[model samples]
Target chain A: MDEEWIKTTDKKIINLIRLTRKNTLDYINKDINVSTKTTRKDLVTNVDKSNEQFLVNNIREIDPKSKILGEEGFGDNVNSMSGHVWIIDPIDGTMNFVKEKNHFAIMLALYIDGKGILGYILDVMQNKLYHGIFGKVYENDKEIFSPKNISLNNGLMGMSAPLLINDYDNMQSIAHKSSGVRIYGSAGIQFISVIKGELIGYISHLKPWDIAAGKVMCDSLGITVTTIDGNALDMVSSETVLIATKIAHKEILDLVK
Target chain B: MDEEWIKTTDKKIINLIRLTRKNTLDYINKDINVSTKTTRKDLVTNVDKSNEQFLVNNIREIDPKSKILGEEGFGDNVNSMSGHVWIIDPIDGTMNFVKEKNHFAIMLALYIDGKGILGYILDVMQNKLYHGIFGKVYENDKEIFSPKNISLNNGLMGMSAPLLINDYDNMQSIAHKSSGVRIYGSAGIQFISVIKGELIGYISHLKPWDIAAGKVMCDSLGITVTTIDGNALDMVSSETVLIATKIAHKEILDLVK
Candidate 1:
């Protein structure tokens, strides 16, 4: 994809996201019709599927030859980030959507031949959108600078309940050494907190759709996003993801390692 | 205070809270000048003191002879909840206010002759107020019905990081048995979640101002508010507080025991 063409596509995709906001809000305000996936903890709702279909259809209309990897399987079975691929998680925090009715997001990203071109994460209820183009991050229309570099002992950390209980990779110690721990039950919400400089870092076992959009946003802001160990992220597979400031990143990896 | 007098007082207090919203918002949006209280984790800002003074001055004008218990130490030190006492936590979750700027709240409660007459928790950013009058709970003037009676394993629980890390009273086991765990870092926010039926229970070590208003609201909705060991809460002292749906309360007590 050409650079100029990618800019045009970004505007179109953002408008599409804004257009779908009302329908998603309606579904969230009303009773959510839900069904379980692999486990009872894993939930899928009508809104999740409908939102995915809505995005996938519009993307297909805009770029007929583009490949899309969607959470609800409405798009292609993308094995790799080939030319002109869009990755989306229509509703990243489906459990929060079903139960709390807040703290969830609509995440979408665009890649051109294995390189991220654009990323967007829209917090549905708050109406706040985090977008990144190439290597610039923006909240709404204003570009966001890098958050202050704080260490693990001076800032809060977000963790998964499963990891905390099982003490996976010495997570308990990582949590103990941080200023405090917060668990909002949504990976997207946690990611936004880090982007806004509220949380020092976030660690959880996440699928590709869960971290794809967030990863781009973090990378643009000079934040570190990698596995529990200091390693590069495999964008096509589920991995133990850790996102943090530079100082906290090294401290957490040392403890968890 | 008589019943009619209490009603009038509630109206006046609500108006005062509404009037103070602008000043609080100004402080939060602008630079918040913060100071350390006992430790760095325990924070007190200029806004906290100003909000406390605002409430105390208004309450004194209304009832000059009344006693007040305040977090900022601007009010009277009443050893007993003798008559016409007010408890105010100018800003519950100050850490959240200073850090997140969205999850903190203004909490106030009125007790007449050692009986809870009114309680209010205002989520400043969201403009949602949770109040109760003598066993009747309301969310911004709309009456709230009782939350469903769900047991521990069937519902989500909100807990604190200290409790989880120390495994206080076997908290880790309780968290493991529940559907999942959530930590919002604000006791008032967690209380509102329970009142709104989003969380089954919330447990934390809280001061009197932290839980006084929330206790009144939860009791009105038939939710259990008590010590972790199932003992009655001491109204004038700090203690470990647990707010939960009735069934979950009993189950958690059994497990902790």
Candidate 2:
């Protein structure tokens, strides 16, 4: 997606994501079909399937030339990021959606030749839509200023709960060194916090759909999103990723290493 | 206060809290004066003082006969929860209010002769008001049903950061036994999660205003709010409190002990 094309599709992509949220909310009002995938912690709901299908079908119609990768396997068998590729997490934080019925999100992102172009995340419960077009990010209709580049000691952090609890890679020390730690139980919600500058950073192992939208948005601001050992993120892997402000990012990378 | 009088004050108290939130939002738009109270974490902002003053004055006029204990020193210095007493935490999570401008709450509760009567907690940014009258809890006028009594292994738990990080009182084992762990950085927000059955329990040290509203609400919902040792909560002291569903409550008490 070129700059002009990215700008042009913002309204359409946003509208489609908004409609997706409406449909997801409607499904929650009725009984849901939930199943355990790889593990009990790894769950997929009927809502996730239908939402992914809806997004994939619409994206294929809107951009006939693009390839798509979706969490629920509703899209193409994507291998590489060539030409135009869209990533979809029909419902990020499905656990929260199933357990809490709140704090869940709808996420979508567009990439061109492995570079992020446009990304959208809607915190459906809060009714807040956050999106990035190239280098400018907006909360709803208001463009957000980049958060200050603060160090770990000066800011809060969000960490994977199990990792933080079990002291994985010195995560316990990381949590204590920061001003505070938060675990909202949603990758999308935690990404929103980092993008909005509420949390200086978050560390989690994320699949492609989970990392794509945030990576695109963070690239616009001066934030860092990389593998735990500070490598470029693979476009199609479930890798341990660290998303943080520039300064805190460096501090954490060195500490964990 | 009689049950009838308590019923009459519902609309008035709710309206006052709503107005206080309006004022609090307005203040956030302008510059704020922040001062360290006891510790950096235990901060008190200009908004805290003013909101407490506003609530204290209004309660005096509305009830006139009740004694008030407020977080910001705007009300009486009472040692006991005797007779009609009202407690106020004008801004619960002041750090969050000052730093994130979200996830904070405005809290007020009424106690008659050392028994909980009415309690109100407003999640300001979410614009969600949850209250309890006598033994019935309401989340914005809609009555809430009792959450299932679940054990530690069957549900998520919220642990205080320092305790969990340092493994205080075997917090690490407790966190591991539960399905998951969360740390949201706000007492009021965590309390809401437990009352709504989102979490099976949460443990933290809380002051009077911090515990009052949640305690009253939990009393109505069969949730447990007590000292870590399972003793009755002391409303005046900053006690280490554990609030949970009944079964999870006992399970945590045993694990921590």
Candidate 3:
């Protein structure tokens, strides 16, 4: 892929995703009826489905041959990551958006021939975006240098709810060694923390869209992004994902596995 | 004790505490000298010790004969609440202040003749203070009504790190029943959430200063503040404290105990 073309498309997609987030926020904040998608486990408000549809429509217009893997079923059911692929999570932290009205984000990533080309994470409340073009990562407009590589004991770590409780692969022991564990219920926020070096690492069982953008951003920053067992991440599948600095990643894998 | 007198002293104490928080934020944000007070577990940076000393001096100047219970040991060792007593946590979330440079708070509570007269929790980052005077509760300058009674299954809950892992008295079961759990490593932020009706409740093994202001604010809002076993809180002792609305409180206590 041409680097200049990737940069241009990345900027366009980033703006589109930001617009989608703004629309989603406005829609949810408006007086709209809310219905449960499933008892309590899943929720499909109008904003969520509508935002996904909006992203799909824009991406289809821009890249007619690309495949989209979205949280909502509006996008095609992608089983492989060949050619150009766009992975999106319209409203990443749905629970926080619905309940607390804060701490949610918009995530989008582009992959060409199974290689991550662009990544973007928009933190809605903070109004900041962590984005990467090709191999260069930026927070908002300025380039963000890689954070200091601190061990788990010296930094905070973000853990998902399920991993914390069930000790998913001995996460409890790993959490004990860290300064502390913070669970924000949003993969995007967790990923941002990992990139900012505020958190040594973030671990969770995530879908493709949840980890797609994060994986590219973390990898570009010289941080390690992989499964809990130190296996390479399969971009097309849902699996346990870990994003961390090199030292923290090794420490966590050793402690957990 | 006259109610009018209690009200006057409460307002004065809240003002003093707010000023102390401003001083702490100033000191922490800039370069400051620090020394280890005791073991690494118990830290006494210049900001921590100086903030407490400032609070104690102000309390002495305002109420010469009042008893004071403070975290930094600058005040007299208060054994009983015979007269006016002020419980102060100069820097409530020290680890967060030292590590993250945010998410910490200053907590202050006034008890007149063993009764809570005033409570204040300053969320430094958001710049909002959850305060209580007599029967009214305010977040910053605006009065906030108590949140609707929400069940454990419908709301989020906050818990301390240790309790979550050790399953201290079966807290895991209680957490499992709630919609989700959040651990922010700051008693002040956790308490603010409870006051704002964000979290159904917050649980932790807390010192008197850690729980004092939050307890008074929750009490004023018709929320229940007690030990995990449903015992009234002892203002001078550290215990497993649980603060929640009526229904969520009962449900969690039932599951935990």
Predicted structure 2, TM vs. truth: 0.94
Alpha-carbon interface RMSD of model 3?
Answer: 1.5
- List candidate 1 stretches off by more than 4 Å: A29-31, B29-31
lDDT of each: 0.88, 0.88, 0.83
Instruction: Give the runs in model 3 whose Cα sits over 4 Å from its true position.
Output: A29-39, A134-136, B1-22, B29-44
lDDT by residue (A100-187, candidate 1, tens digit) is 6778899998877867788889998889899999788988999888888999988889999888877899998898788778999888
State the TM-score for model 3. Answer: 0.92
Ranked by DockQ, the better of candidates 1 and 2 is 2
Residue clash pairs of candidate 3:
none
Q: The CA-based lDDT of model 3 is what?
A: 0.83
User: Taking candidate 1, what TM-score does its chain B reach relative to the real chain B?
Assistant: 0.97
Q: Which residue ranges in model 2 land beyond 4 Å of their true spot?
A: A1-8
RMSD of each: 2.1, 2.1, 2.7
Top candidate when judged by DockQ against the true structure: 2
lDDT at B19, model 3: 79
